[model samples]
Target: MTAGFEAIEYSSRDGIAVVRLNRPAQRNALDLTMRGEIGRAVEAIRDDASIRVLLLIGSGGSFCAGGDLKALTERERGALANRDRIRRLHLWFSELLNLEKPVVAAVDGPAFGAGLNLALAADFVLASPRARFCAVFARIGLVPDLGGFFLLPRIVGLQKARELIFTARVVGAEEAQRLGIVTEIHSEETLEPAAMAWCRRLLEAPTGTIGMAKNILNQSFNLDQRALAELEAYAQAVAMETADHRTRVGDFLAKKPLRYDWEALGRAEDGQ
Candidate 1:
């Protein structure tokens, strides 16, 4: 259990941490208080070593409706003040992004604007058929923020991303899947189970190796071959020394079942 959180529900089970945005009355909008809660929740997860994977979901039906527009308009701030505010947001956003553990987003209703970007930050996005995603910034006379400009183009490519951002199109789950924005689609009823199952699969993986690989791969496109090769060398060297690497190798030589042996998983499925 995580304490002192009002905007989100936090719990852990079987090495999985479930963080659910809890303000359904407001559609779980990203107001100042909710933002602060998120930052605290992220830090708690960061400091806990027992939690292996993070499952990010929303309470009630809606995932998030973006920033609290009402709150924004209510506050009269100067340019520097607004800029500082966004910078403050990035502080926690960067921490969440750089978390070494796997993150799975279980999305069910509307994920618009910053909400959409929030889902994108996850390593895997599990969307329900009813899920609606929109960039929605153009309609509000705002450019994409919250790493949208960077993440969207990479996932769906430049042309399609431009089309979505410029037109402020509302994308359904099916179309989002085709465009590679969504990793998988499940029924609304099964979304949580699916996300949890996916988290279990990730939990079986060697965490250190996966984290290092993810770190390198995230930067692969930006780095030149030489730079990437250097990173790969360093990461592989570190990976080679992990207990998981040694165990898997030893298991193979001894004909013992490896943790992630596909044949083993297949046999288990068949038995089930």
Candidate 2:
């Protein structure tokens, strides 16, 4: 476990890593230290091949409430500190966006501002039935940062994104799902478990294939239809070349159900 997380808590289970923002008092409002640690952890995921999935969660009822406003107001720093804070936020997010493995967010409560965007960064999100998301930046006379502008519009369309950011409106989990923000909603008690379950299923999938798909999906943002079609063909060709895919295809061609050995995974990726 990392230290001083009075702001966050982290633990590992099976092959899944859980990162919990633990500061209920201030809603896990991020500061410099928390951001640095989280950025480190996120980037570290790539090197830990034993782990195939990651769960980003929170303690108390708040995932995170953006940067701790109270902490900011109390700080006595030159403009440099403010710039550094914003830069740190971007660094953490870049770490998130660059992660190679599947990431699942199990959101149990409110995720606002940077918090909501963090949830959005995951490959998919599962929220508690009562969970709420908001773009509260405008509400407090702040502009959205931390990739919100780049990600939100693509998830919900330009018009809906504008309303969300401009009005600072809150959306429930169901509406979030409708807007393609969340993939499912679980009972509060099962939110984290369900997210992990989903992550485990993802781990069983072909690792190289998922990584390639993610790369292609990220590039879909800038590609034309023809280019997208070409990429799809290329992706399918590459996915068919993986060891997992070859094994499964052999089973399929032989009309047998493919089986995997759990013990084999630890030996698969660079012998982690």
- Enumerate residue pairs that collide in model 1: none
Candidate 2: regions farther than 4 A off: 1-6, 76-81, 226-238, 258-272
In the range 1-272, model 1's lDDT, one tens digit per residue, is 77888888988888899989999998888999888988888898888878889999998998988998999999799989998998899899887877888999999999999999999889999999999999999999999988898789989999999999999999999998898878999999999988987887777778878888878877887999999999999999998998889998998899987787545654564465
TM value for model 2 = 0.86
Model 2: per-residue Cα lDDT over 116-219, one tens digit each = 88888888899998889999899989988778998899899999999999999999999999999999898988887677667666668666677778877877
TM-score winner: 1
* Whole-model lDDT values for every prediction: 0.88, 0.80
Query: What lDDT, from 0 to 1, does candidate 2 have?
Result: 0.80
Worst 10 residues of 1 by lDDT: 261-270
The backbone clash count of each candidate, in order, is 0, 0
